[model samples]
Target: MAGILIIAHAPLATALRECIAHIYGGCPARIGALDVLPDSDPVEVVAQATAEIERLREDNGALVLTDMFGATPSNIAARLATVPQVRVLAGVNLPMLVRAVCYRTTSLDMLVEKALAGASKGIQAIGPGTPAPEYGCSPTPCAEAAADAAEQAAAGATDNVKAASGLSAGVLKPAGAT
Candidate 1:
């Protein structure tokens, strides 16, 4: 499995890790997160990130996820691009991180593809007629089923939830699921 590192501004990195832990019942192995504080030293942060990457990287190398392009975190992450087998992706989000974690066991190149795809697909504009409590109504069963069907159709015609979520068969389970 490739190592996965999340580098972002203060609190976001740690929070994303915590959220993953919640989703998967626990944070999976070969994962590390570093929060870059406003007052942090760039040199020291780079050293720390390199160490973490070395420690976490396995046969598949590592994937570094950062917040924004041209920011401190991305700049720090960019430094790792020269490292053999490492890829840096900016604009980290929950869906992107989840997809990366789910697909970490794949080849490094495949993992990058999955992460970028997840980042794009996770974004959606909720418009009128979508059943959401925020919109003040539950979706009818038919509407929900249609939505599920459409989503599955969009997921490369895969019916398996795990496949759609970028997980291998029988690999991961949410917290408290049997």
Candidate 2:
């Protein structure tokens, strides 16, 4: 019965809400988004998000996630943090949003931690040598091959002097060239 509030810049809030709905299935009644309405003032947006937070708290405590620290949305969330049953986390990412939706019923403190952890885990590198392939096949060579092809193409198209000097075509200054 608890809620998760998402506050982001204009236009982004709606997209994020849809993404949350897609990932978590059927939008949550308690969930709220700021900046969706036309010409919405920051204070009004905060109040609206806060209203939802209060509602959720009456039902069960709520967790609020904002897109950036010290931004309007996060500032409002910070104000709400003083409330006894509310918790706020800034720098919200897709992973944190999804985790919050999935664990909406969790304790406020635990949900905050889980959302932070989800955000952190979502940023990990997905390149080769990162356990991406079961057989441990390296992807470095593939990247190097692409780079080599690009270099070869550049070398073939440019003058030898430019190539020798490590400068792209049309990049040399007459005064600087010997």
> Each prediction's Cα RMSD?
6.6, 20.6
- The C-alpha lDDT values of all candidates are 0.78, 0.62
The global Cα lDDT (0 to 1) of model 1 is 0.78
Candidate 2's residue-wise lDDT over 46-80, tens digit each?
67876777766634577877887987767777888
What TM-score, to 2 decimals, does candidate 1 have? 0.77
| Model 1 lDDT, residue 96, Cα | 87
Looking at model 2, which ten-residue stretch has the lowest summed lDDT? Answer: 169-178
Q: Write the per-residue lDDT of candidate 1 for residues 110-147, one digit (tens) a residue.
A: 77987887888677779887566765743332233234
Query: Considering only N, C-alpha and C atoms within 3 Å, which residue pairs clash in candidate 2?
Result: none
Best by TM-score: 1
Q: Pick the candidate with the highest lDDT.
A: 1
